[model samples]
Target: MRSSFARSGLLTAGLCAAVALSTPALAQDKIKVGLILTLSGPAAALGQQARAAFEMALKDLGGKLGGREVELVVADDELKPDVAVTKVKGLIDRDKVDVVVGPTFSNILGAIAKPVTDAKVFLISPNAGPSPLAGKGCSPFFFATSYQNDQVHQVSGKVAQSRGYKTLYLLAPNYQAGKDAIAGVKRDYKGQIVEESYVPLNTLDFQSELAKIAAAKPDAVFTFMPGGMGVNLIKQYKQAGLADRIPLLSSFTVDESTLPAQGDAALGMFAGSNWAPDLDNPQNKAFVAAYVAQQKAVPATYAFQAYDAALLLDGALKATGGKTDDKEALRAAFLKADFTSLRGAFKFSRNGFPVQDFYLTKVGKRPDGKLETQIVEKVFSDYVDSYLPECSIK
Candidate 1:
């Protein structure tokens, strides 16, 4: 039931077709790394981009790492927690991969955590940093190369506090991620949460939700609806004529991938993220140029982070003289502060999360009719999660 790299979009046919065609000496073999993501249904586009960027990184790595072939196994978790567990199980039990990367959603990440740990394989999370793992829920085998979910929103909430918005309305999907986002916002902003509403995870129709937000009459509304849900919410927010009425503050709902699809509706929306295509860093400029040249498009934050993850992994492999199948050795190599990512200098927390900057972005349109995200403010510089004290790494 496990699909190979070709069908999974992590490798081309030439690679899979050649899997059996390798010389006998090739039996010295490659270390297999499995990637599980929600590659279909509502969040398909997010998973697709994550997988695409990841494969492109391997391709950029010339299909090999540490002198050994790198084989990627991808599974679709369909954005469901239960499905994620099943997919991880299949990858570990059937494919016996040495390392794992990605499931994208924080909820899904929580689902796959135990199985991957029980199997004794390292799980490298390029996205999805739930707060629990940063605290007492921390796992030795789990490493998040991306920021914790609270990092960006905590920044956004603090922005609200600085602006002195007294009354704020909050909305998010009734899921683990949504609750975490609300808690993150609350952690920083000491404002009147005039109202808070939890909508179903798949509620694409938001007129009802919009009404509650409107009636709350709050100075601002904070939300964390990523993927397709964002597209629907922005469109409805515009249609409801709420765009100019009440300020909209968000985390992960507006980005390169979502901006274009959102078009004029997203113009001037308040957002925050760790990386934007418009960041003024030299590494970001190079990453944006190279990414556009490769894909003929803007790279999403997820793509940039995943792209960085690959380079980080590459740095780890090379540091250890390209010998990485050894799990403990690989973990040590990975924990070393060794690489410059597209986000510039990168390092991990003692508990395996990012300590990085967060930016406040405004959704604006370029003169050429293409929508773009422009930085508007700063939340925190070189911020680490407050829950680090609860982690057991030290």
Candidate 2:
């Protein structure tokens, strides 16, 4: 009886030790991520596409990021800056997420960037690469999977200049990105600016802007309206009889996110982009196929960038051996960008924004009757953001 009791005591001790050891291992095998976006309002389509693409990427990776199971917490910023700050704080303080990914607009990014970085947590922007973040406001903890706010618009400006547009009319929302778009177009466009108009963000009624464009009668109209605003502006621009009279050159105004709504009105319209469905690369082909199959729609730059964000995190975590505790090691791993991007050639600039190709794309109807942005020509190859010189980091 005494021998049996001693053996039982030993077994209990071994079981307790095993449980204690396994607990920490299991805890370390999972990492939490917070996904915040403008999942509501007129721009909801953009956020929805991003959310779907990230989820699709997660699924493609067998629900693991760098061999660690991902615990994803999604929040809707409703395109409001204050709401974004509050939600991001909750992710940091309450959920203790290891990484934070996105609010889709520049204004929201401006609101939340300081808070997330101040906490020493990694923040990745799948969209909305505001100019300030790319310059003096750059942060070690902040990275953008998208181009700088001005890069695509710069592509538009170059295209306009090459096409010999001598006079151009510009319009954008009155916000940081809006201002950036105007600056980008003007950077390379050494021409007569007939007029520059700034409207409030999310202004669905463009009758006044359309009137202004008509009155200006520039050689071309370059505008940067996005989301539902894009839809309304394009439709109203066509309805107001300006579509044929003057060419419309834009960025983000007639994209995959808004194309469905813009429909035939946006057909043959040109925009600047970093990727298109017809971009011929194995990774891009596969991604486009999967996105169309699953989502029943063409993936926009927003979707591709968000998908890339997932790949970015996966690659960085793999380089860190799935460890999120070491900030410097993780940041270095991200700087390496050890994953094949959907954009064929992608790398990080000094400011942690993408250095990739830019394209002049045209909206065309696919054989299957689905509308998509198709690549017309590569505008800039391996383009680095112009703000690289301002970043303090090497």
RMSD of each: 8.7, 1.9
Please report the candidate that would top lDDT against the real structure: 2
lDDT of 1 by residue, 188-265 (tens): 899899888888886788889898888888999999888888889999999998998999999878777777678889
lDDT per residue as tens, model 2, 113-196 = 999999999999999989999999999999999989999999889989999999999999999999999999998999999999
Quote the lDDT for 155 in model 1: 67
> Where does candidate 1 clash, by residue pair?
none
Which segments of model 2 are wrong by more than 4 Å? 1-22
